[model samples]
Target: MSGNDILVTDGLSKRFGDFSAVSDVSLRIQRGTIHALIGPNGAGKTTCFNMLTKFIAPSSGRITFNDRDITAMRPADVARLGLVRSFQISAVFPHLTALENVRIALQRKRGDSFDFWRSKSALEPLNLRALELLDSVGLTSFAYSKAGEISYGRKRALEFATTLAVEPEMMLLDEPMAGMGHEDIDRIAELIRHVSANRTILMVEHNLQVVANLSHRITVLTRGRVLAEGDYRTVSENDEVREAYMGAGHA
Candidate 1:
């Protein structure tokens, strides 16, 4: 792998019993770039994510991050190495205030996450950082509101803020635009652009327009393997991608 690569996978494969979910997939994501993974439903995109994030062990393959082998690392260990994944489903704590959720994530990053006896004020630095992250994601106005009280789109933004508090070097975002209205989608896209300026982002998205607008490169998967990889225009115009999308009625 080259020095500029932040995430690399070689011959990555995953299986469940007799079923192969992802097969012989090799990917390289450059540092400080936004890369999109696009595929039809049941095409193993989420399975690939599970393998990458260590949520599930890959049946076979090698994964390297920053030139270090990480194929067998635990999820938490991978996270501590500045690799973080935001789930497709919302993950914010509904009962907690947005600021509190971000503060909790900040505390986790500071290694004091389990120190329950410490007063909230004792971690004033974490609170400050959390506020800064919330501001960055445009959630400062709703900082004190319960996460559940925020609009669905704003809740997603809060989740992004929480992820930012972890200070990840590479971020894995699963459908950040899922369930969003046009205005919310525009706002989130801008936030993603701002975040991608400093950190590498690998996103799994179904919205081709958003993918085209945000990604520096696009990787298209079909049935368990890469069918095409290139810029939006290149992939969209590729025969294999066109066929895959047409077969799935999503072209």
Candidate 2:
């Protein structure tokens, strides 16, 4: 692995009985770069994210984060080590106000999430951090709005803010732009670029244009294996990628 690599996988594989979901997938993500994974549906991209984040155990292989072996670590442990993931679906609390949701996440990061007896004013620092997160994601104007009342795009943005409360070193984003309108997509693309400036971002996305625009490097997967790995031009021009897309009727 390169000295600057923040995340690495060697011979990673996952199987459900006789069916292999991911096979011998080795990948390296450099620090402070946006690395994108692109493929057709059911290409095992989500499975790979689950294994890397320790949400699911790999059938075989190894994972390293910050140069430490973490293949078998629990999800919380992995998260605590500064590797955080944002789900494709929003994980925000719909009933809570946007500010409250972020405040809760910040409290969790501070290990005070279970301190329910304390009044809101007592946790001044946590509340301040939560506001900072909301401002960072451009949601401060909606701080008092119920999370469920926000636009779908803004809710997704709120999710990103919650993830930032943990101050991760690296992020695994699953379809960050999913279901967004054109304007929202542009906004999110900008937000992603802003966030990626300080940390490594590894994302799985179906939008080729977004991937081409944002990713410094691209890894194309097919049939649970890597078909190509390189820059936008290289992957776009690759024969294997062309074949994969053509077979999926997306070409």
Candidate 3:
């Protein structure tokens, strides 16, 4: 860990039987910036993400977040330290309204018991914060709607709101624009930019245009190893990157 990096990985590796999913991957994510990890399909992008979120343990390496070694930390422990991963659509409770969902996240952040259901006054204090979170993600219109009833884009915005409820110092977003239309993508991009003003964000996204536009720094991965790391123009113009993308049929 250095003065510049909020997150650092040293010689991270993951293996499954004869297959090596990630090999000697190291990354430095600067404080209060949007950093993106991108690669063609089968480039071990997802595996690397899993490791960082502590969803899967790395076979060998160290992961330091905010100057603490989290290589052996559990996912819940990692989250408690203010490093949180955005949940998938399925992770949200279908029966709960968007406000209720964000309220639940706020409750968890306060380390309160799930017994908020018992006392109306107990959760009243969280309502204001939850509404603020919903507004931040542009989901204020859907605040009272069921999370499952919203459009795909709206559901994602609600999820971002719920993630924000946790007040993470750094957030890990997985493909925030994966299934959005152009308008939805644009909206979500702006939401991300707004929230990132005070915190660091690292995301794994396939949307090259989104990454190019939003990321302050980018790390390109190929064959389970880092192929390049720099600004979009520098990485995009690299001959090796062009060849790799072309070979992968993604150019």
Please provide TM-scores, in order, for all candidate models, with all chains considered together. Answer: 0.95, 0.94, 0.94
Please give, for residues 106-162, the per-residue lDDT of candidate 1 as tens digits.
877567466778777777777778888889888899989999999988888899899
Worst 10 residues of 1 by lDDT: 242-251
Candidate 2 lDDT over 51-102, as tens digits, reads 9889899999999999999998999989999999999887789999998888
Task: List clashing residue pairs in candidate 3.
Answer: none
Candidate no. 3 TM-score: 0.94
Against the unseen true structure, what C-alpha lDDT does each candidate score? 0.89, 0.88, 0.87
Error of 3 at 168 (Å): 0.6
TM-score: model 1 vs. ground truth: 0.95
Off by over 4 Å in 3: 88-90, 112-117, 246-251
lDDT string for model 3 (41-98, tens) is 8888889998999999999999999899999999999999999987533357779999
**Model 2: runs farther than 4 Å from truth?**
246-251
- Ten-residue region with minimum lDDT total, candidate 3: 85-94
CA shift at 102, candidate 3, in angstroms?
Answer: 0.3
